[model samples]
Target: MPPLDSVLAGFADAFTLFNLLFVVAGVAMGQLVGAIPGIGPVMAMAIAIPFTFTLDTLPAVSFLVGIMKGGLFGGAIPAVLINTPGTPDAAATTFDGHPLAAKGKPLKATKMALYSSVTGDAFSDMVLILASAPIAVIALKLGPVEVCALMIFAFAVIAGLVGDSLIKGLIAALLGLLLATVQLDPEQATPRFDFGYFQLYDGVNLVAVAVGMLAVAEIVRRMAEHDGRPQPAAVPQSEEPGARGVSWREYWGCRWTMLRGALIGTGLGALPGLGSTAAAFMSYASAKRGDPGGVPFGEGNLRGIAATESANSAVMGANLIPLLGIGIPGSVSAALLISAFVIHGIQPGPLMFRTQPELVYGIFGAMLMANLCNLIVGQLSLRAWSAAVKAPASFIFPAALIFCIAGVYLSSGGLFGVSIMLIAAAVSLTLTAVGIPVIVLLITFFLGRRFETSLSQALTILDGDPRALTAHPVALILLVGALATGVWMARRR
Candidate 1:
């Protein structure tokens, strides 16, 4: 544990005026963006990264974290009101949320989502704080061989969990690995896939690739599918007295469901690459299984709303566990956060606690603060977000496209960056048009370089001896586990 003074200093750092402003701004933006269909927290974070390049570390990260936290709950607003999930994680919420809205209780459903979201978020944040240090301690003991095995295990797990088709998921992951091999060789300085383009010598710009695939590609897809129609009004019962609020009895009745969902979310999120969408659905399923005949699930059940919202929102904080403890991002949002950390000269891993304890604890403090900010801002901006969701898709996508381009150009510093972004966006769109899972590709791309570096180091330590693996039981076990999981997933398919 960090000393009392260090912890206090960290909280003090996160409590600064600059950090607070960014947090509030980020929450507001997240709520707005998330309330609009076809826009999500990942897209918002990708676009926001460029603007953060000029800010100090704490404020920049606080801003992004605030967005992620707020977006979790914000997504449920559209799900409840219009039956359109603003983010993938909120899809399960639509099951009961829209039904509640149909019954003229949209505000009650929205408030249930809000309260449950904050509860789960706070639960996961506390778990993150309690678990991160111990996990980091164990992670620090891992050798290069063990690290390599762990990476392989993560790859196998992600490939299995991401998509329905195992073959497609594996293909996507392999393609990401191939793309990551571009630029100079890790061992020697010789360039590998530059194609004689001088600009490729430094490899693909992380910001450009990330923004293109996540933000620009989505924008392009939405634009390609655009109809000249405004989205339906979100709040169907905006003026109905019966839909005004949720009572304490209604909220407390689903406490067990909320707690179960939070636990499910936190557990799944700590594993690398199993995302919030999965958590939400899993929690919803569990709730349905446990429900003892009350309003019926999928037919305006408050418990169903509580379950899905809590689980999905809980994932936002829990996903950071792997990132902070083992230096592996569990989702696209965490990957963007890792990029932000790198941009600020901070490296996340076991040593981060020792080398930058203040910064790490400051981030913890900021996360807690962001949850509070998310609740307050989400409540106050409910009407504004409902109004904003009515904006035409034609207007939103074009503006988003412009923002994506500008953000890439500004962050990467020229036409070269813009070109890279455009190329990446094209490729991402092409991949998505097929049966491929672009999310798996993006996650693998983020982790590939680290896997490669660890593999190289492990091989060097082994001195080219194949028998050396027998000396490390942990690595052998992890590799075997990975192989077994892969085979099982293949058979299940």
Candidate 2:
């Protein structure tokens, strides 16, 4: 554990006026973007990275974390009001949220989602605070061989958990690995797949790829789906006589569901690459199964909203566990954070805590502060978001497209980077249309370089002897676990 003084200093750093202002700005921006259908927190973070290049580490990171937390709740706004999920994680929210909205209780549904989101986010933030250091300690003891094995295990788990077809997930992951091979070899200066392009020497730009696939591609997909017809105005309707905010008794009734969802989110978030969308769906399913006789789910049940929102929101915090603990980003959002950390000259993982305890704790404090800000700013801006959602998609998507292009250009600094982004966007759109899971591709891409580096180091240390893996019990165990999981998934399939 960090010493008491270090923790206090971290909090003091995080509470500075500059950091606080960025936090609020980030949350407000996140809320606005998330309420607009087809834009998400990941896209917002990727786009915002260029703007943060000139800022200090604490303010920049706090701003991004604020966006992440605020977007979690903001996604529910459109899900409840327009039957359109602003983010993929909010899809489960639409099941009950839109129904309740149809019943003239949009405010009630939105509030339930907001309260549940804040509760879950706070719970996960506390868990992250208490657990990250201990996990980092364990990680610090692991050798390169163990880390390689751990990456393999993570790959198996991600492939098995993400898509309906394990084969498709593996294919997507392998494609990511292939893309990761485009730059110079780690051990040698020779390029592999640069194809005579000097820009490929650094491999694909992470920010460009992320913005292209996650934001720009989604925009293209939505534009393709859009007809020339205007969208109906999303006017707020009057609530029924009893359809005000959630009653305290009703809130208390679903407490267990929220707890379970938070736990699920935390567990999954700590694991690499199994994202919040899966957690939300799993929590919703579990809630449905556990309370088969309760108020019918998908029929305006508040517990359904509570389960989905809590789990997804909790993931926003808990997804940092692997990133902070082991230097491995567990999701796209965490990957963006890793980029931010790197740009700020702070390496993540166990050594980060030892060398930068104040900064680490400052980030923790910032996360906690963001949660409070999410709750406060979420409420105050509810009416504004509700009104903004009424704007035409045509206006919104064009602006989003311009932002995507400008963000990619600013971050990468050339037409070559913009070209790569456009190509990635096209590929992403194609993959999505073909039913391939783009998330699997993105997560694997994020992890691919780390996996290769660790594996290469492990092999060099072992002198090309495969049996050397047995010398490390942790590595052996993880490989065995990966095998067992593979077998189980195959049988299940």
Candidate 3:
């Protein structure tokens, strides 16, 4: 770990006026996009990434983190107001949130969500601040052999858990791995699959791919799904006395439920590919099971809203654990962040701690600041964001598409990048239509080169001798874990 003084300085660095403005702006923008149907934080972040090219690293990352934290709560706005989830992770919130809205308590329901969201986000960020360095220290001791095995385990677990069909998930992961091999081979000086394009020699632009797959593709999908009719506006909140907000007593009542949900989210978020959607649903289910008599979950229960929002929001911070610790992205959002880190010439891994401890600690500080910004911005703008849920898909999708094109073009520095983005969008759309999870493909593509390089080095060390694996107990254990996960998935299938 860095010296205590260094950590303090890093935290202080995040308090600059420029950084604070970015955090507030990011949080506000995130909530607006998240409240508008079909434009969640992931898409917003992907579209906004290129605009951060000239920003200092700390402010840029802090802005993205702010968006992530704000979006978690903003998603609940539509879930409560319109019976539509703004993001997949907010789907669980609809179970109880909409019911509460129907009862003329839209304000109360949303307030519960915002409070729990901030609490869980702060809890997870604290966990990340405390745990990431130690995990990275331990990870630094592993050799290529162990890293290779660990990657295999990560892939196995990701494939098994991401989508309903394990076979389809595996296929998507393998396809990503193959596509990642398009650049020059690591060992050989020659390009492996450049297809005669010089741009391919340097590999596909990560920003283009991420923006295409997430932002542009989703815009197209939403536009196609629109029925060319104006949707109903959000439910009007109660104007009666004492009905416009959640009281401290009500918020304090669900404290244990929020804590349990936060714990579940943090645990699941640290693992690769499970995603916040799963965490929210799992936490909701657990809350339901544990509280059989209180408000009867799924029927306007404050506890249900607390459970889902807390768990999903907790995921924002906890998902960074693996990325900072071992250089593996735990979710698609984190994969996009990896591109951001790379763009700023900072590689995330154990060495990052040794070489750029200040940056890492600053990121931690920014995360905590984002939580505060999310809460403040969300509270002050609840009614405004709730109203934004009525935004038309036609206008939003086209505008977002423009941003996607512009962002990718600027980041990639050419029309070639735009072409790649269009192609990737087409591919992502097709995959989504077929029920294949695009997230699995994107994350595997992001990590493929590292996995392949580690595997190659491990093999060179072994020299074709299978028995040599015995010398690396960590690798053996990880490989065994991978095999076990595969078998378990097969059985479940």
Q: Using lDDT as the measure, which candidate wins?
A: 3
Q: Can you tell me which runs of candidate 1 are displaced by over 4 Å?
A: 234-242
lDDT of 3 by residue, 1-493 (tens): 8888888888888887889999999899888988887999999999888988999899999898888778888889999988899999999999999998888889999999999999999999999988999999999999999999999999999988988888888999998898899898888869878888989887788899999999989888888889998878667667776567888888988999999999999999999988899999999999998995867888899999999999999887899999999988999889989888878988877777888888889899888888888888888998889778888777889899998988888999989999999999999999988988899999899888888899899999999797999999999999999999989998898
Q: Which stretches of candidate 2 lie over 4 Å from their true place?
A: 235-242, 290-295
For TM-score, the strongest prediction is 3
lDDT ranking, high to low: 3, 1, 2
Instruction: Write model 2 residue lDDT over 198-302, tens digit each, in one string.
Output: 888888987788878888898888888878675456635665665758889889989999999999998888887678899999999999998846658998899
Q: What lDDT tens digits, residue by residue, belong to model 1 across residues 1-493?
A: 6677887888899988888999999888888889988898889999999889999898999999988988888898889888999899999999999998888788788888999999999999999999998889899999999999988888888888787877888999998888888878888989989988888776778889889888999898888787776667654575666568888888888999999999999999888768899999999999999998969999999999999999998888899999889888888899899778877878777788878888888999899999889889878878788777677887788898888889888888888998988898999998888878887888788778888899999999999796899999999999999999889999998
Superposing all C-alpha atoms, what RMSD in Å does each candidate have to the true structure?
A: 1.6, 2.1, 1.2
Off by over 4 Å in 3: 292-294
For model 2, what is the alpha-carbon lDDT of residue 191?
89
Cα lDDT for residue 160, candidate 1: 82
Q: Which candidate, 2 or 3, has the higher lDDT? A: 3
lDDT of each: 0.88, 0.86, 0.90
